[model samples]
Target chain A: MSTQLTTLLAVFLFPGGLFALVLGLSLKGLDRRVAARLQGRIGPPLAQPFFDLVKLGFKRTMVPATASQPVFLGAPLVGVVSMLVAVALVPVSGLYSPDPMLGNLIVLLYLLMVPAIVLMIAGSASTSPYGALGFSREMTLMLAYEAPIVLAVLAVALRTGMGQGGVITFSLTDIIAYQRSHGMFLLDPVMWPALAAFALFFPANLGIIPFDIPEAETEVLEGPLLEYSGPALGLFKVMSALKAVVVLSLGIALFMPLPFDGIWGLVGWLVQLAVLMEIGVTVVRLSMGRMRIDQAFGFFLKWPLLLAIASVVTVTIVA
Target chain B: MTDHTVACSYKIPVGPLHVALEEPMYFRVAVKGETIETVELNAGHVHRGVEYLATKRTLLQNMILTERICSLCSNSHPEALAMAAETIGAVEVPERAQYLRVIAGEVKRVASHLFNVGILAHLVGYEALFMHAMQVREVAQDLKEAVYGNRMDLGAHCLGGTRCDMDDEAITYMRSALDKLEPDVRELEKTYRTNGSILRRTRGIGILSHADAIACGVVGPVARASGIQYDVRTAAPYHVYDRLPVNVPVLDGCDVWSRAMIRLSEAVNSIEILRVCLDQLPEGPINDGGDPYIPPGQAIARTEAPRGELVYYLKTNDNPEPERLKWRVPSYPNWDALTFMLKEAKVADIAIIVNSIDPCISCTER
Candidate 1:
């Protein structure tokens, strides 16, 4: 009974539900403000995204007559639930470690894929032409980015598993422990390629510019979300916010987690996430334009794929 | 093994309310997989009967009416109509007024071109570049407000000459504004020229060849970008342009990148022209301000608008209102060329190609 209560508290209160949602929304708000400053304009208030979400909740969720009602309503809920579970799985260094029974790195990887898959399903179910175009583009981009991400995960798993005298370990606690004692893979030159590949995956997963082809607001009018209104749309926004925290935290745990303990460690972790969001997501997106789906596909196949493979080979030889 | 069937083609309709377009123009793009098979364009969504209204209004009233045709090239319409009316009445425009007209026209060109390029960046998915481009354009907007007393529609031109004239303070302000705008534009030019990602998206994406450009009657930077050296300012110099030397930037790359580069280079050239006009500005009355009279004659006047050559034909018969008023805007010729440029292009390249032509729907539909 006590264990059940702890699990509930961990999932809902501390790191997963409300906590991740707030942190994610705040980071998004900060990104918008900084981007506006870079462009010489005064941006929205930092809490504007929260206001937008609340406003969206009061509006009607009008489902198109052509759309599949069950799938259209269910997609955002599934996405939000998957991300909530994923967030609970990410360890906050010395502050907290997720219960091993709940999940691991592999489970988190599967959970990370839910949002994109949900978008594709929603796009198809919406029955709009833009939604269909978005569905095709989303599928193409997923096929392109998924390979590099898998190889990047493999590189990290091998680096951690070999360090601990095992063939492989899908455990997040083990990976973090190995990095804490032996120093972060971020500092290791052999793991640099995996880090580079992960950097490429970061913006693509978050739907920032350049890799934001799936939901190109200009091209397809927000594509899959065109038909989604009110609470359903707000759910999509919530899912994305939670996913940002999960993905950013996952990247931290895999690569450059600080070795501090207690509250200091958690604060350090948040600082790392903020810096990554600014540099990796905000500044880079502001500087460049979006590439075509084919251009992006070709780019992934050439650069990130090569880097991911090189990282795996170097880790196999070094470890 | 002998099954015979025809592959179905998909029709993707992009907006009367689409995200990529600023004005409402519908496009029924036929595609086989991701490649564009054929494109059918439908315009006239923002059509107002300005020409019909012109028939009812007097010549002076029509000057103001013509300005309302399109805000981007608002001054060009009135200037062209004024020149046509001046030709019929045999009115001599003051030397200083001609210089002032050139200044107003060139300033409008810089702002309009910057806006088009900024939209191109937004469509390309380079949000930072787009914002930076617009920020740079704000300097021109400030210059317009300081000199012409308005940001968008300057309302500078009148029947004989210009309605506004620059004082020493305004000239100094204009000079200083150009000084600040030049280096920022150069830096943006460097970014557009060298950025690898931008190059990947723009270069060779929307090829409008030299022959195709001429065949389609393309004008302005769209034609110049395709290696056609046809600019009305140089081809048939108007106002003070004959006295002021101009160099038109021509590129043979004939794609979206070339079109963008042409606009950037032209904007820089416009600054140079503005500098020369200010330096050679004569000392005299800005306008004739005589009794406005219309003779029984027909005359046509052409001016190099920001987009291209804008031609206005005016006919009068000893009456306050004209008999007929007609105009040939640049967007009219360029709209037909989209079909050729968009052929064999990807769905993602649709917006980029459409923007490359810089089609002004209001100007076209009008």
Candidate 2:
């Protein structure tokens, strides 16, 4: 196949479009089921997310009269597209790797930001009070978490780049390859702070219970998505599922992608992803309550920011 | 409407129908960047004209009508209405009937308070704790269903005394249910008291000062949470509450957490009260045999409901129906306190603060 055809196939077929959507929706279903079990209730089935998507598809997409029609309708499409491409960008260890020319870690970071940006745009464009409130909240959360993530990514880049006789490298493949050759970065004490920083970023970026202030169902009635219904809402769901796979897979690729190739690599990757989802998402959401926006803002600034800075400073010294 | 400054560009209407509120009470909140500058509460969506309905219905019929006024505080309405009518008619409630009334009130108190705290957890996004609290409340609900034959609207009170009489088997079932409820409630209380997520959201979020609490004349847990020592069961000494070991827990925190803790303590206290009611239940008649005649007169009676002090006034005429029937629910006073609580409060805290009052729209509007 030509390079462009292979890239298209990669984006639309394998690790990106259809496969990531299925994987992401199933993970969400599992998260809900496990959360229900943890709370001592019979939760929905594993196919519940898919069922919800189908239900959403059958319903009409109602747009508010006051909302900016194009912007409001367009945001979810942009979000879904970005996530599909992002899933392709993230190489799943030995099972598949993307063509480096498609873009690198820097491009992936920008794509990773599209969902939050889409939310902000969707919120603002909807012209509802709660949506505007959500826009500001998403903006604030993005600002708060953005700093640590940049520093953490830079820390990893520095650690890997210096190992390969370069000052810096924006390539995720090189980082994965470097980690593969010299053992996993997760085991190294130098990368632990960045890992911790990344760990904290997950809940906020994913908009889970503690940092879900922007879209608190009780307070804002889903904030940005309050005015959204039908297929538009389903698109947001699709974006999230793809984003979860991308983010969790990004976490693995960044710190702890196992060194097994072929089917074993895919199995190890699946197990690791499930473990991360179960421990990181389900258990944490079940255990903790939501934080007020100001408190969450302060928490990200004080702890994650400090940890990221420490990781960068240490990576500079150690590498 | 005592005082609040509304200074913001956009006014948000948080409904007669919203996710946070159990009942329909619209709040017109003005915000200055996610911080609420003022809140204008518009009530009466649940205005079923129960007060007017009460006057039209016969005294015997009003017992059933009044219970439908509010689901959570259902027992209190008829209990207070019955007390006022009994006082007006110069009818003394039988000793066994009074004990049964205490048992009914205490059981409703436990269920209602658990519900309020459970919702608080839900608003904080701690759904696990919310579900667990609800599961604990389910035990109380089962106790109500087994003993009173309804999950809500327990029609236990009559004009002269109690309508529902518990047999020995029902009493034994209640003891075991109460046993299952107590430890679960204790564990829930500990979580709310110490859990980081709950504390972070609620500890000092909604400040209803002790001075503000007194000025608002807030009753029930809202009053007790703000350090005001008032419980109608203890202060007014109605219906064997004086004889029973009723301890009112007071806190000076004057916040959402304090309100929740106050409710939990009351729920715990209610279990003890229920136990005592069962143990010392007299073996005489449960009522005056049948509905006693209520002669022409006027009287007022107060009772400490699960929320706070619930007041009812009654005036009887020659007709079968009363000439007038009115009430002052605890939520009425506690509702105004939200204006103070929402002042400069973060928008996210609005629902939590509103819920902290445990405001019942049905009773307030009726």
How many steric overlaps are in each model, in order?
A: 4, 1
lDDT per residue as tens, model 1, A1-319: 5777767777887788999999999999999999999887899999989999999999999999989999999999999999889999999887778888888888899899899999999998998877888888888888898999989989999999999998677888888889999999899999999999999998889888889988998877888888999999999999999999998999999998789999899899999989998998899898788888888899999999999999999999997
lDDT of each: 0.89, 0.91
Candidate 2 interface RMSD, angstroms, 1 decimal: 0.7
Interface DockQ of candidate 2: 0.90
> Can you write out model 1's per-residue Cα lDDT over B265-299, one digit (the tens) per residue?
99999999999999999999888876457788999
In model 2, state the lDDT of residue B139.
93
* Worst-scoring 10-residue span by lDDT in model 2 chain A: A92-101
Q: How well is each residue in B1-366 modelled by candidate 2, as lDDT tens digits?
A: 666775356789998899998888899998889888778978768777788888899988988888888899999999998999899888999899999999999989999989999999899999998998899999988888898888998889987889889998998898999898989989888988898888888988789999898888899899998999998888889988879999989999999999999999998998898898889998988887878998999999998888888899999899999999999999999999999999999889888999999999888998
Kindly report which residue stretches of model 1 are placed more than 4 angstroms away from their true locations once superposed: B1-8
Q: Write the per-residue lDDT of candidate 2 for residues A1-319, one digit (tens) a residue.
A: 8989888987988898898899999999999999999999999999999999999999999999999999999999999999989999999888888898899999999999999999999998998999989998999999999999999999999999999999998888888889899999999998999999999999999999888888999989899999999999999999999999999999999999899999999999999999999988999888888988888899999999999999999999997
Off by over 4 Å in 2: B1-8
